[model samples]
Target: MIRHLTNGISIVFISWIVGMIINAFLIKTKRYQEKLTNLNFIKSKKINKLIGIGLIKWTVKNTFFKFFNPKLRMNNKVEPNDLNILRNEMTLAEINHLIAFIAVAIFALSMVFKGKYLPAFIMMMLNTLMNLYPSLLQQENKRRIDKLKKVFTRNHVSVTATESLNIS
Candidate 1:
């Protein structure tokens, strides 16, 4: 028990330091965002289907966890800029959560080697089903939103330009 306590505490301390470093690195760089957004994950289908898959989205949306929902209530097609900001925020959060998931999973795997098999298994399952899957889902949604924004903005701009030209 004492050994487990010491090891777990040390792991938590190290995880915190590593997480802080990853957070700093991620925040300082915006150049990689396009790359992140353009990833071809689950590309065979539309991003929405790739993400939610029926009851998962229904449950997640209905659950309305404040952490997941953020503040995306605008008429997205009308408020493209706000929608973009929200999407970007979700993307960043997904990246952060993914990093945390990796860190925790690694620690949990280490625990298994130390004979804490049940706890490690439980932690791994929790992170996989909760954190990792949610991050993937958020990334897919962001990708879809990015596509929608581009199409919406292009049509909005061209139509406006065309109307002004016709008036002139």
Candidate 2:
């Protein structure tokens, strides 16, 4: 049992590394975004509600962000261009996670046939926590960004028009 468990763990870790590398390559090549965007299957509202993201565990997410979401150079106030870029980055990441989820599913399913049930179970749990939860967070964030975009666009145009009138 110990040996089998060790073997299963090794497989799961190897799968994770390979999946990350493949997803990174796809992202570097700019293929993931277009591919995922075309599929258009991620429905944020239902997914979030289904996962109970709005519940009390959101505090855990806040804690998770402090450690994992390293915003290296982001300031308190971001320009519209920067916000758009961030939104795109989140979208791209969410897609890569979707890919990761699929890879995990494949690995788990494949392992079950080989009698590595423990590893398969581990992979599925990881898939739920890492891939699914993060995707939901990204979707929630993107929606928030969209709201900001609308407000920014509205305010920016009005401010520009006011400046033009003053100059005239």
Candidate 3:
């Protein structure tokens, strides 16, 4: 059981590395970004809450994972350009975790076919926790960023118009 658990953990990590490599290659493509932008699996914030995404978000922020990727962190004051950069980063992260989840899931399914149910179960559980939830969390964050961007754009445009009128 220990061996199975260890192997499962190792597979999750390996899958994560593979995902990063794959995402790095794909990130430069416009089609990939467009597809990711249109991808909305969980549309409702309530559904996100129901799935315990808040817990995952809290864990990532509070744990060593926060230190692992500092780029994802946002400051108190964020401009539209900053939000655009953050949205791109979130897309990259979301795709990475999604790839990792699919890779680990495939391995787990293979283990099931081979009659190694315990290891498969362990692998799938870890994959869901490490990869799936994180991807979902990123999606949620991207949605928030999109909303914020709209607000920022609107406010900026209005402010600019007001400034122009005052100058005139």
**Tens digits of lDDT, candidate 2, 1-168:** 566556555654455566567766776665555565434345566766787655413643456544444431234556688666777766665666666677778878998999978778876776767676666666666666676668778887322322221100
**Candidate 1: pairs in clash:** none
For residues 34-130, could you state the per-residue lDDT of candidate 1 as single tens digits? 5654444455445546554433445566675433445533332344665567676666656665676789888898888899887676666656655
| Residue lDDT tens for model 3, 42-154 | 99989989989888988897788787667887765566787788777878888988999998999889989999899999989989998999889888887777776687777
TM-scores for every candidate against the unseen true structure: 0.66, 0.66, 0.89
Candidate 3 residue 48 Cα shift, in angstroms, is 1.0
lDDT of each: 0.58, 0.60, 0.80
Score candidate 1 by TM-score against the native.
Answer: 0.66
- Angstrom error of the Cα, residue 144, model 3: value is 0.4
The number of the candidate with the highest TM-score is: 3
TM-score of 3: 0.89
* Residue 149 displacement in candidate 2 (angstroms): 1.1
By lDDT, the best candidate is: 3
For model 1, how big is the CA root-mean-square deviation?
A: 8.7
